[model samples]
Target: MGFWDFLKPRSKEHVEACWPGGKMLQVHMEYDTEKTIFTYFGRFGLTFNISKSQLTGAIVKEISRTHSVLQVYSGVDCVGTTDILPTEACNIMKDWLGQY
Candidate 1:
């Protein structure tokens, strides 16, 4: 598959929630049976990569009906936490990791 294909969420809820402002231009992800490499591309030259085999968990907490927080943990460290919309986006990420 194409590099960005995995970034395409399966549901409309994911499309709206994961990319609230349409700021994401593309994404590149590579994963094997046990590890994942994720790269994010934004419209305003914003980019970051998270490649970790020690991902401990992904937690989703609701703040409102349309908003939630996604917290990512790596081993004992909280690597990333950010707000998302619709909430289902959190599950998608978690499921992606579960596959590997």
Candidate 2:
């Protein structure tokens, strides 16, 4: 490893969730000290970045605790929602965002 490696942002982190009917959803996240890029798959295949400024006001809602439906919102727009494991949701909301 090079000395500057420490200054570099972390590599992308990937997580996937599968539904009963063979439907699968995956999230790829790349986070730096300043911002994070979130990529979603399955139904809505789109990728977007959320900076510190936006993350400060971002909202993550647990629509169904039992079903593990988590909704993410930026300002008034509904970015998207996913059905993932409860643990995954917690990690994203707490661990990931907490780093900033």
Candidate 3:
């Protein structure tokens, strides 16, 4: 690997959620080290390379012990929101992305 590549932090891939196509969501913790920012990066629909962001643009919340809230957005607008299991977060994100 190149020097710069060696310096870069490795990313963890979430294969459970596949989108836009062959790409899976990737999470990088404290990616830059300098900024110490955790980032989620993935592509959407082939043409767009979404960054800092996953399946990063998606938000999951726990409203109850048995149910979680899944929220997806397109830009500033919230595209979809529904209560779901925590395990369903990625799957729900895929569905919203497909529809919106």
Task: Compare the candidates by lDDT and give the number of the best one.
Answer: 1
lDDT of each residue in 2-98, candidate 3, tens digit only: 4355467755343222332223333111133333332233222111223333323556666766556555555775544543344354455545444
Tell me the spans in candidate 2 whose CA falls farther than 4 Å from its real position: 1-25, 33-44, 69-91
Once fitted onto the true fold, the runs of candidate 3 whose alpha carbons sit more than 4 angstroms away are 1-56, 86-100
For every candidate structure, what is the RMSD over all alpha carbons to the true structure, in angstroms?
A: 8.8, 9.8, 11.9
lDDT of 2 by residue, 1-100 (tens): 4546547884544432223222233444444442344433333444444554555333444545543544556777666554454545534544444554
**Ranking of all candidate structures by their lDDT, best first:** 1, 2, 3
User: Evaluated with TM-score, which candidate comes out highest?
Assistant: 1
Name the 10 consecutive residues with the lowest summed lDDT in model 2: 15-24
lDDT-best of 2 and 3: 2
Off by over 4 Å in 1: 1-35, 40-48
Task: Give residue 46's error in model 1 in angstroms.
Answer: 5.8
Residue range with the least summed lDDT across 10 consecutive positions in model 1? 11-20
**lDDT values, one for every candidate:** 0.50, 0.45, 0.40
lDDT of 2: 0.45
Clashes within 3 Å, all models in order? 0, 0, 2
Which of candidates 1 and 3 reaches a greater lDDT? Answer: 1
